[model samples]
Target: MSSRERVLAAVAGVAGIAAAATLATPGAAASGRYQHWDDTAYRGQIEVVRSADGPSDPTVLNGTVFVDRDRDSRHDRNERGLAGVEVSNGREVATTDSRGRYRLPVYDNMTVFVTQPAGYQVPVDEFNVAQFHYNHLPAGSPDLRYGGIAPTGPIPDAVNFPLVESRLTDDRRLSCIIAGDLQTYDLDEVEYARKGAIADLARRNDYQGCGSLFVGDVVGDDLSLYDEVKGLTAQTNGPARFLPGNHDLDFDATTAEHSFDTFRAQLAPAYFSYDVGNAHIIALNTVRYPCTPELDNADGLRPECDDPVNRPRYNGAIDATQLEWLRRDLAKVDRDKLIVIAGHIGLLNWADEGSAIHQVDQVREVYSLLHGRKAVALAGHSHSIENLRTGDSMQGWRDLFGVQSLPFPHLTVGAIAGDWYSGQVTEAGYPTALQRDGGRPGVLTLDLHDSSFQERFTVTGESDRVQTQLGLNSPTYREWYVARSAWNRNPVGAAPELGDPLVVDQADLAGGTWLTTNVFMGATGSTVTVRLDDGRPRAAVRTQAMQGEDQLVGPEWSDPVAVAEQLVHGGSVADRTMHLWRFALPADLSPGTHRAHVTATDIHGRRFTDSLTFRVVASR
Candidate 1:
């Protein structure tokens, strides 16, 4: 594959990933020519007064799936309905009739949504956000901290959805953006998002009709700020969809049933299914809230674990209803179609890696259900990016999930608000929130070709070609890291000791230094190699084998760039990972500047090339 080489001339003032590629400038003026839609479509709820009469019957949510011949979001006199499109209202599902009309039982605070059928497109707002659902909360949120949901007077007589004809969803290729954890906790963080990932997404046109799926943690506990985050998503050139995260829970709800009430009122179903071309997207609600002892008892000591009454807690498990719904939902989907399952806590991860509280308890069951299907799982909440290929294994997964190998590609697809959007602020108004894994904040795109696909991670403000971070892990840097880590844990007065980490001297070389490549989406079979000064390319060894071994951590396994930035700022340490490659630097090199061209090949055999120029000086 050919790459567009972006010279430094086109890269000035561009921060983060944008500075590394030949894409649009990070914060450039826009032409305002992206897909536009109705922001006001999200009708707020209305307070329903009880005078011995509230809504007693299931509100009739009737609608027609019409083909907008002229791309308008309204049914014209001559326009006809598109039959067989699936629609749902939280629980009970229904299909459009032959005449493109259908009705579902909707209750107060229930969202009536359509599972976008193949070969057709939904109406997208100005920011290319797909408008395919309606909020039906006659009485809005029962007043809480984050405002919850506003009141929608009464159920509409007819709730219709408009879709236009498009070849994008009909084609073999499905362009999907797996954006995990846009966890904006406040209004200021919302601004940071606008300047960062949102800016980068706004500049692209690849995923216009088919959208980006923000897996979880759309916000950081402040549900009222949802509109603020949605404002940021309005900049993308694709339809936007989301799954709920633990931070999105309605903490005031005493029972599990009402825990995600705010989330359901605001975003999407607690758990639902959708489709785009050949892929069947299953958005599951794996988080069981008020996760008291009755649910999550993995903590060694729990006397009242069986007590059913809810308390403030969260667990990683799917309830009977959701699981049963999943089975029934999958029963209808064609076996040949790719199953794209997404959630928040992740089926498994490397951060908590193998804790029972983090991974779902029914992973083996999920694996069993997906037997013989071409599938992949996407998740977040661990605040790290992980691409666990088929057959990949770790001790945690084996011990907790009771599985020795991954059945398919289970990508803990990083986070949009990387590391809780932590780190120092940038000129663009966003933080340089490098993730806990040392990866810069980013989104993952799955380029689907039939049942198979190529996964690509785009660092915010960076291009697709920018996939790896190169660093120098010298003895001096390692020592400084150790001192700094201790100082952080116990706070000493003395500052950390370290020199210019990138530059090496004779004594430093003798002490052993390595050139490290932190391949962002690298998996078990992925290989990274570096060639110095256009010389022979020596294969760089991956730090962790992911073969049932304990995670390899510390400075040797760390990404120097992430460590440097995160250590200065307040956030989780990027001390260990499943995707880092290192190469020992030659001590006998000539003392001038030299360029190292590194090539990383993913499991699918696609190559991403990156280069860095480093100096070998006498002193720093």
Candidate 2:
């Protein structure tokens, strides 16, 4: 018989038996108790409908549906067949047959969802939100920002599924895009972000099939924009996922644990794990609520922490339950596969004070869990670029937690809105320079091949370049120097002696200092020393040795106009800002010129040196 006809016959038979059971158990039925049937009651008879054309003409599909007696969302032991349960797709509804099977019509762009019964729950995504769809249109639909179901045709037959009464598990190789902190509080900024970022993704086919995931801080204090954020995401070519950050939490939430209630209800899973393509991705909720008692003070803020509004504080620590769950989850994963952990707070950031609480305190514990394997951790609260290549030993943890750095890598991904969408607008109608290192705003694409992964930062509208280290020493360096001097607290004085370059006479180099335009930062054992052409080497002092964060320190120019003029004319100046040094040579160095070379070695023992020659003028 045809699939549809077979489904009808099975349903007819099951209905007859159910009617007889109803009569036999009249007294027992009063309490809503009935003999649950096993899978054998309706073996291969039930079917589901599918169609390759469109939802307009769907075919029958053969599948099994069980009665979740335990009321858990998952299919578990002792759960019996829930025959006659009705499943539907707005247009058609079918009841489970004798074997707890049901045949229903399904179409692309159409939702074939089970009409969740009173005590039963449907499946939810990683965000712990119920799984629902607008519709499935393989070919896509209209241009609505939050596009609903597409108008694709019907799918294949036998698209039957099993629905249990317990929390469902979805372990699929998902391709998800992660965007950080779309913290748009106002409509204009929201539109700007949409025009710049949302518009860019709307037209792309790269993440079409796979959905997108926004790491956190979806909105500013104005939680009303959650819908607007969702609207923008709808414009994308795929589904969108979200995680909450400090800003996303409801400051007005009644209780500490309920801070993310509204967010949870709206977006789903707050913290969850999913598997995709040989990698296990875990999204954590690090922001705690209830500023009164303080949630563990992970950020080092005390119960009386000072804040104008006295709002709750946040830091990076999982609750006991979540921590336990994490340990269990990590235990289930294979060591050989990559484990990608993501959160709103970075393990390390340049924006925050050194060793902030938002940074993982139990980093060693987490690192130890994934020890001896390839893993990648990502965070985004800080809108900067920082890569920590902690060697195999987790030694860095010894001081903090008797732990060290793991062999794996930890990276802080730059924001989709680099520098809070700072800087001047470019020809592309977006901020071109938002990163501290002068890197443009964009997304990070990781390509995994077997056990290893290659990461590339693709600047918006540019080609992919795997290089992460930035190189500076040309005219760009000069411009930076001039800018630094113009903002310096000290200016240059009269000229110096024959062999001496411009020198600053002891000034406060504490704050707002500007050294030279050329800054060479190196890791431990890496040196950045400057030498005069006359064979006299200037001793470089260790301004700051930030094992946790990176910083640049040096001298500054008191007079900015002179520095700017010198920079314009390619002349020299004496200043230091952050980690740079500036110097102007004397006029009478044999009337010829001399060379000053600057060399830097990285932690890896790689050396780079650059030298510049200046023509010495005769003292007329």
Candidate 3:
């Protein structure tokens, strides 16, 4: 069978089993299943009440945001309508009147959705996926695989939205979870996600209000696994929302307009924004499938996308319509509130800092929109953790996108399905899936208080305290890295092991020895200091200065500790990272065991310390 057919069959098989299966919370009783937000007996749906003779005006669509006190999907006579609730038709924004009624101009191929006002909660499906939008496609999608959105005829006389009051979103302080790349290929990878990142989110109650916003790549090429993917979110504590990534596209589609039709029908609008606390979180769709030469702004770097026949590919871009929508969306947002811009691909990142097809093309326009306001960009796709601060620039960004420096902080939150779940399985029921930058599978959270926020990354099944990874980089290890890396390219036999990584000889130190620290979220203004046993603290220099320079890659900039695990077990090499810091070891150390303590201070002034021990022998 063809690969597409195989994917469809796999999706069909999983969907049947997923419908009957329940994702039990970790350590909870088998019978104790978490309840969905909109599992009412009345069948939760937007109350699209229509007149017997159809609507008087088809051009204008009307809606009401009502309080669903009885938990019914319908808006009862007694149930009052919510006032000043925001609603949109992808481009135009409208708010509910005093009577909770909102009217917007109707259009083809538009998604009508509510902003989900603060102090109120939107109902969720059985998979814990938030239900706040309705798709209106008059004629439906053209012939395509994965069956895009079905036809929804004329506009209803009234499309009322149901909501319930919640104190969770009312708080001024919010903890917003930004999970990246849950790129599960099949059912097995789905299980790994359930055990890894989903379990971590299930165990936490801190983000119930702002909820968990998964930043793209919800699955691999199999769009049919969306249901199985949604089942994982059923185990989490908050209303799960999602953004579209390159992997999440319906590749069978020919046009860019219908590229994400299946995703929008199943997950969310391609791009949208909502307000919570003092922050206006804008979720963007930065990926454009089948990018033609007319659309690509990569300065001919992405000639691969120019081919529509043999190799129709996706490019990191924001269409003119989406950019205009973003401008309109920002105008409505308060200037004092923090603007949290999120997408699948970053505006610019450390891993793909030099790749034009990997970063957004319209990033400069986006920066101009929030010219002086307090804003931060968050993204996935790179599968690396990067906490880049203002003024961080790269030669590629300067040459390709005409961007010299970052206007504000831009972060690439590490993926939950690290390196596509490519490593050995651990006792925790998940893969040791180390990322490209030597970071583990984890989720990022923005701890926001009013207009200010701090970013934190929690490694899967690990505590927040476990931030930095320590390793020894010596001449011996560098040689092992070169050998193993070459062998990894064309495997023939058992791989060469990095022996006694912490041990080094006189010649090894003389050739250049250093202690490497991979601070997962370390950025500019952050400092890494190392202290030997009973010695003064010595400063460690960051490998990448991020000051309009080219990427410093290879073994010299690698995290030896992480590379050891990846090469022996199986995963991406930690060859290059923007967060690595190295402290040169003294060559004249005595022939004995020595201890080194590492302390990394972040841009937020928060400090995390780790320690490692190594031996100094006369000869190996």
Candidate 4:
């Protein structure tokens, strides 16, 4: 459908609307994020008019947006209500009153939340999970394997949200963290999280503005690990938020409505938006649960299990309801501001580039709505680090999402629990968890300047300076790859086929050897140039041109350096990607120690230079 048709559909969604109370956030500054106000109120206290009485009354979903003067997290007798704070029910948007109060018509499973204003910080529990929402599910969820929302009986006299005054997020300059999956299946993996990325975040105070938005797959299939995930978040220096992933769902739930109840009860809303400075961040529930009757096999992509009547399959598309809700939400955002759209499943991807079910079906619709606006999308679920700039394209995106090319920057943030915490356990106690494309496990940050920004990736337990991974892709390495693939299919030795990785012989150079670098945030307009031993500079070629070619995969396309670590230590092989670049070496150069001074420049013109030295032997 055209963008116009989608808007008309959204307008049609506002149907069945009944007369309601005034909606407004009183006595607040008007500009940017929230301007117009609507009033809300309910009875002294709301009773869960029995499930038999039908869906909870829409108008009685009420709450307060107050100043927690003591930071006690509850409305105290002397605490004054802050006016003009916007509150929303995903569909119907409202604002607080002069008394810092709000009310909106709500149903059985609606999320009533406050879009935290700019100057004040929302209250975070010990785990740094922001307390900005109140879920209303009067009768609770039906019986399911993962326990969902317990009946949140009658509405309390007040569902109060506390905001503390802060100077950190008051302006246009902001640092928003877009972290990929931390798919920890057990407590041990949680420890890896603690020692790796969480520890790194604890050392910095910069991201307190937009905080950390863990894209998804927060945990493996086990919902029991939610608290441990919370424990990891508590270690961060700023507030943390989460969106649900395919693994984070209750697969046993009979219907879609209760799919993420437990997650909603423990984390932030399944989908929500907030603003800081000029950046408007929207977190979405991109994963659809029970995607297949069973699991993915080696033969093909996971089957669509979403047989609503039988075995349900998870999918990578947004439903009509969410599309309508997104339409309504974006309607409130300004045209010129930065819109950071985040989801678990990427809108389009290079990893799983062959699977149509791994990307969103509504990618085109979303692009249509966000066309005129300054936008960037961040996602997880595909464990690779991808920075797709405007005009970046791949066969899968065009074939699956129907998107010919990226309209704006679309990034696939690297995972925190890299490759499912695979590889060797470090002395630091974390696994190398090298991703499928060989990118290191790390997090991404968007340094916002008004509506535009520069993207940077920081390897965990390392500095921002550690931006690229250098490796050798030679005939020798390719031979080892063939052997390794065979051995992986059928074991041959204790150690894999990877030989001494850093060394290259005359034969290896004679056959052809290329120095490869995987720049984590490299994208279109980026340049990778090399100068050997102070020789003339030469530009390297990016493997995946992203101009509508099929994805290049397997050992032939793998990064030798990351492969060396992953193959021997046990993690994913970084064998394929769009950002890995290679520079051919001169075969006749004299046998001696040589250094390749490599310079990589990102789309933003940020240059990161690093040198790799290799000893060329006459014969080894």
Scored by lDDT, the top model is: 3
After the best TM-score superposition of candidate 1, give how far the Cα of residue 398 lies from its true spot, in angstroms.
1.1
| TM-score of every candidate | 0.85, 0.54, 0.91, 0.86
lDDT tens digits, residue span 215-267, model 2: 78888767777777767775664436567788887666545455665565456
Q: Pick the candidate with the highest TM-score.
A: 3
Residue 247 in model 3: lDDT: 93
Clashing pairs in 3: none
Candidate 4 per-residue C-alpha lDDT over 1-620 given as tens digits, one digit per residue, 9 for 90 to 100: 43223222211211112111122211111222321111110001111123445335545765677777666566777988889777777677777889988777767677877777777778676677777787778788888667788888765545677777755567566677778889999888989999999998877666766678999999998998998998888777566889989989988886667789889988878888887887778888887665543432222444555355576767786766777878877887778878999999988877877786788767899988887888989999988999888887788777655678889888899999878998767667887677888777889988777677777787887667666777678888888777776677788666444444556889988999989877777777889999899798899988888888888887657787777666555666777877899898889867888888888877666677777767788876
lDDT to native, each model: 0.74, 0.47, 0.82, 0.75
1-620 in candidate 1: lDDT tens per residue? 01111111112112222214334321121223223423212212211223344434446667788887766566777888989888777666677889898878767667777777877776655544456777766777675665556787776657777776666666566677788898888888888778888888777766643578888788988888877877887777667887888889887776776777777766667787777778898898878876666456655432233454543667788887677767767777889999999999888777776567677877888888889999999899888889988888888888666788888889888888888878776656677778889877888887777777777788877666677777778877788788888888888797574544556777668888888888888988889888999699999999889888878878878887678767756787789988899899888877988888888887766677777666787765
Per-residue error for 358 in candidate 1, Å, reads 2.2
lDDT of 2 at 354: 41
Error of 4 at 258 (Å): 1.0
Q: Which stretches of candidate 1 lie over 4 Å from their true place?
A: 1-64, 68-79, 101-111, 124-129, 134-143, 147-162, 298-311, 587-594, 615-620
For candidate 2, the lDDT comes to 0.47
Q: Comparing 3 and 4 by TM-score, which wins?
A: 3
lDDT winner between 1 and 3, please give it. Answer: 3
CA lDDT, candidate 1, residue 549: 88
lDDT of 1: 0.74
Better of 3 and 4 by lDDT: 3
